[model samples]
Target: MTKVAVLGAGSWGTALAAVLASNGHDCTLWSRRTEQAEEIAEKHTNEQYLPGAVLPDTLKADHNLARAVSGASIIVMAVPTKGIRKVCRDLNSVLEGPVLFAHVSKGIEPDTHKRISEVMEEELDREICQGIVVLSGPSHAEEVIRNQPTTVTVAAKNTEHARRVQDLFMNQSFRVYTNDDVVGVEIGGALKNIIALAAGVTDGLGYGDNAKAALITRGLAEITRLGVAMGANPLTFSGLSGLGDLIVTCTSVHSRNWRAGNMLGKGKSLDEVLDSMGMVVEGVRTTKAAHQLSKECGVPMPITEALYAVLFEGQKPIDRVELLMGRMKKNETEDLAGWS
Candidate 1:
């Protein structure tokens, strides 16, 4: 049994910790709040984030950072993107030895435009971090905790490390795949949330499937364009992290981004939508970073730009939809011609 420490007590972290514990690994989940830690340990349920889901009894919880990571050989970071750097720094300060790190957060740093793994690398000491791996795809925490069949990919610059993570998480109900295209995986996972938000808006606006389908398709195009310019393989955009993730996040009620966008489309202000959700909608922050990235990379992301206006400039969601639909005509495959 491998020793694992999953940082953060959110739904994703708790679900992953349950997976590890069920695999007979020595796993501990760390929560910043002592009450949360006690609740998880004694009750085996993180109702705040994952209501009605019971965690594995063998799984342990701790509020102390040092205690949670004391003897762990693998550290799973499931905190939000904004918390990644601080968690990495905290882990580095307390870690006694180098450990493999796997992150499940999907987001782009607002100002730095760094992926979650990048943020980890920047904050973690090399001496304490053996490798960085990103675990992502279409999987949802609610389904995962229920032992539902789920597939996900783990990527890293170090193929060996990626394989190690694949083994650590793979089980009959949960399938794990490995990839060396870290850039593609990270980019696909992060940007899909933006598209999901737009998709949600479409639903809230009472638009039909046609509009949602168009958003998903065009969203993939722009995401691939930006990802390719950033040194990722274009083909990876068609894989689990890309198309697969987009389909699920854009349609599922579990997606916070989609739900938030739905509220916006239904006439709720951005502040009201955010205030009601009470969860970190990664897409809201990612939209800002993605808007900046598109401009910086010279990629035309009309959907992202429209969403940005509605989200930040106080433009009406209906107007944003009009803006997108009324754009000048261009060859759909023109941008993809060079890819082939």
Candidate 2:
């Protein structure tokens, strides 16, 4: 069994640690809070994050970062995008040799506009890092904790690294697929949160299924357009990390981004919405990065533009929706052709 360290005690991180432990690996989950770590280690429950669920008996927890990763062969980075660099710096100070990293966070860094893997590679010392892998898809933490059947994709520049992650996480209830398109996988995983938030807004506005269907379809188009522009395989957007993640995050009540968007659609201030949702809404941050990317890449992301206005430009959500609906028409086929 592999010695695995999962950094982060959030719902996703805790649930993944349970999976690793259930697979008979020596998995240790690290939480910044000492009390939370003690409670999880002794009580076998992370009540705040994974309420009503009991973690695996073998799963351990640690408040100390260095102790958690000591002798670990694989490090599962489940922290939010914003904390990645700090965590990498900490790991660099303590780590002794090259270790494989599989980051589950999905977001594009604003200003720098780098993917999570890029940020990790930049922050982590070259000699101590073996490679970077991304594991992402439509699976939600709530469902995964219940052992509900879920499938996700792991992508990396090295096919061997991707396969290793696949083997580590794959099980009867949790299926893992391997992909080599790191750019497409990362882009799809990061951008779906943006679409999910928009979808939540539509739901809040009481827009019916037709509006949502159109938004999702067009959102996929925008994602595909931008992904292709960023040197990613367009076909990857159709796979689990792309269209699949978009559908689940946009439609599911379990999605934090959707919930935050729903609050915005119902007329809550962005500050208020963020305050209420204790978890990080990746979509909110990703929207800003995607908007910037659209400008830089010369890609027309009307939905992203509309959402950006609502999110940052002080425009009402409904007004932005109207603006989106009122935009001049374009040939759908012609738009798809532009992605090439």
lDDT of 2 by residue, 164-277 (tens): 899999999999999999999999999999999999999999999999999999999999999999999988999999999999999999999999999999999999999999
Stretches of candidate 1 off by over 4 Å are none
User: How much is the lDDT of residue 82 in candidate 2?
Assistant: 96
Error of 1 at 121 (Å): 1.1
Q: Relative to the unseen true structure, what is the Cα RMSD of model 2?
A: 0.7
lDDT of 2 at 128: 81
- C-alpha displacement of 63 in model 2, angstroms? 0.8
Alpha-carbon TM-score of each model against the true structure: 0.99, 0.99
Worst 10 residues of 2 by lDDT: 331-340
Each model's RMSD to truth, in Å?
0.8, 0.7
Clashing pairs in 2: none
Q: How many residue pairs clash in each candidate?
A: 0, 0
Residue pairs that clash (backbone atoms under 3 angstroms), model 1 = none
For residue 172, give model 1's deviation from the true position in Å: 0.7
